[model samples]
Target: MNTIAHSTPVAIASARTPSFSPWRCYWLEAKHELLRLLRTPSFVLPTLLFPPLFYVLFGVVLAGGRSGGDMGRYLLATYGVFGIMGAALFGFGVSVAVERERGFLTLKRALPMPPGAYLLAKMAMAMVFAAIISLILAVIAVSLAKVSLQPAQWALLFAINVLGVLPFCALGLCIGAWVSGSAAPAVVNILYLPMAFLSGLWLPLQILPAIFAKIAPVWPAYHLGQVALKVVDRDGGGSLALHLAVLGVVTVAFFVLARARLSRSQ
Candidate 1:
């Protein structure tokens, strides 16, 4: 009877305790998403290759022998933003759309996982990719391109690039929830590359056109670029207030729209 009584309490305690804690689940899910990204050649290749490649070509080769102004420094910040933006958008956007269409999202939802864990996992993975891109670019800039900055400045630039991926993640979510799997890639590319160029990720915003320069602040990447440039003391005269406000508004609006679209689909 004592043994039975002890067994009964233990059984009750086991029933009360969760099979898996939320934090544990979150960690596992995030790790799973990171692994998924790492294993996929299509995802890993472009995200890993493009930023460093661009920096080596434009920020290094073309930027070579120009010992005056720090063009390499400029490209480092801008291309860092460019690289993170691509990783966040394509990683989250394509995967989210494909999962939803394949019913995997529904399956994940049916599991014991917390709601939005999948989204969080993708964001975490995007940050990981952003870190790698920033590191590679910084190394290339310092070693090959001779773009030097104080250690603190390098840290600041890296942080800016990593955090700047958030707004694009929201935009990606909005696009993913609204579009089909096939359409998501084309839509993302169309929206991404042009905005990067027009936002001065490739060339100066001033060189684009009068109209393009005037509208540059409208692009999220432009705000990110401005902040990044300021890290190395080469800002383009944008107010910090405007940059923060614009990114905050864009993030909130896009996330709300994505959630609404997802709700409707269900």
Candidate 2:
């Protein structure tokens, strides 16, 4: 009786002892994902450099006196969208396929960490890359391109670019779910490059044929481009509400498709 009484509180305390918080695990998992991406030169270099580099070439040097600030501001917004798309698509699309094949994804799923942690980490990494690209582009636009905007415009553009990552991540997830490890790169390029051009990231749609302009709205990048352009008040013509709705639909659809695909593969 004495021993039982003495041990009761200890037993109760042990029973009530908490396990490691899943949120901490989630944070660590997210940090690891970000670090892993940072360590990969192939991933880091192109994503970080391409936007600012292209902006310097096209948005500044070649664009001097083209339309005064119009071209620079346009390129600023478009290239900002382009950069985020690249980061999210490559970060999730290529990484997911490769990881899925290598069994790392499977292993992670089997671990005690929350299943959502893997996805959260990937999305966080994408956002981090987006933020980096935005900062770099803003610096170059102000210092080198002489592109000026109200602070509010800059803030709005940054917000658009950061949130713009979500739809592409979903699209990338779908692509990752569909492709093999080796084919992921080819598939992503097929989707990324042509869409960018078709959606007028490379040139104004009005400058292209009417046909190209007609097709532009079909691409998710087009909607994001419109939103980005609208921030600069250079959007050609489209209800902001419509562009946002299309993007919302695209995001939800791709995510659903990706979820189904991943669920089946497992």
Candidate 3:
């Protein structure tokens, strides 16, 4: 009886343990998240195609024809920011809301994996999408638009896009935590489009009204856009330290809010 009891406890503990190592669990989660978004046409098509299409239309065809390579280089930075914004917002926002509604989060919570693996997976997935978008914009800028830059500039701009996705990811997490799945897309779009425009992702802020230029700094996208513009020496004379500080604060604030809400729900 004693032997049976001891073996029974051991078997139960083994059964409860996760088979995968910690890093492996995180990797698998991220892999599946990327695959899931890739398979979703609504997500994949727009995230991958829209920025390039917009760049081709505005940056390449029109702007390149008018202002020559300068416009292309400018738009390259802006549109790269735009592409990453879309990827991070939709990827984190919609997926989290839907998964939460579907009880997937609860299921994962019951599993034996690390508590942060799910969120970390989503973050990694967003960065991957951001990287792809950045590369595509680089190709379009170099080949079609013929915009030239120093090697370090190109590398810096790409790094900005990849890391810049984090703020939007945090904002998306905040929206997803607070809103229902059905409303998540609408909520994101409401903020995304307006912010992009006001931040001069489509056109330069100098062309916009005075008020918009004044208020542009309030949006995290504007700060990111400025940092990106700095890479090409086209920024609006804002301090790099100021932009980075604003972005850092925005990221931390949204992430804290989202984490609090998620913990409450749990």
Top candidate when judged by lDDT against the true structure: 3
TM-score of each: 0.93, 0.93, 0.92
Candidate 3's C-alpha runs over 4 A off are: 1-20
CA shift at 37, candidate 2, in angstroms?
A: 0.6
* Model 1 segments more than 4 A misplaced: 1-19, 67-69
By TM-score, the candidates rank as 1, 2, 3
Over 1-266, each residue of candidate 3 has an lDDT whose tens digit, in order, gives 45554468789999999676899989998999899888999999999999999999988888755665878988999999999999999988888898888988999999988999999988998899999999999999889999889999999998999999999999999999988999999999999999999999999888879999999988999999999999998899989999999999999999999889988998
State the number of backbone clashes in model 3.
0
lDDT, residue 130, model 3: 91
Please report, as a residue range, the 10-residue window in candidate 3 with the lowest summed lDDT: 1-10
Question: Per-residue lDDT of 1-266 in model 1, one digit per residue for the tens?
Answer: 35544468788999989777899888999999999889999889999898899889987788774845477878888999999999999987888899889988889889978997888999999999999999988888878988879999998988987888899999999989988998999999999999999999887775567888888888999999999998877668879889988998999999999999888888
lDDT value, residue 163 of candidate 3: 94
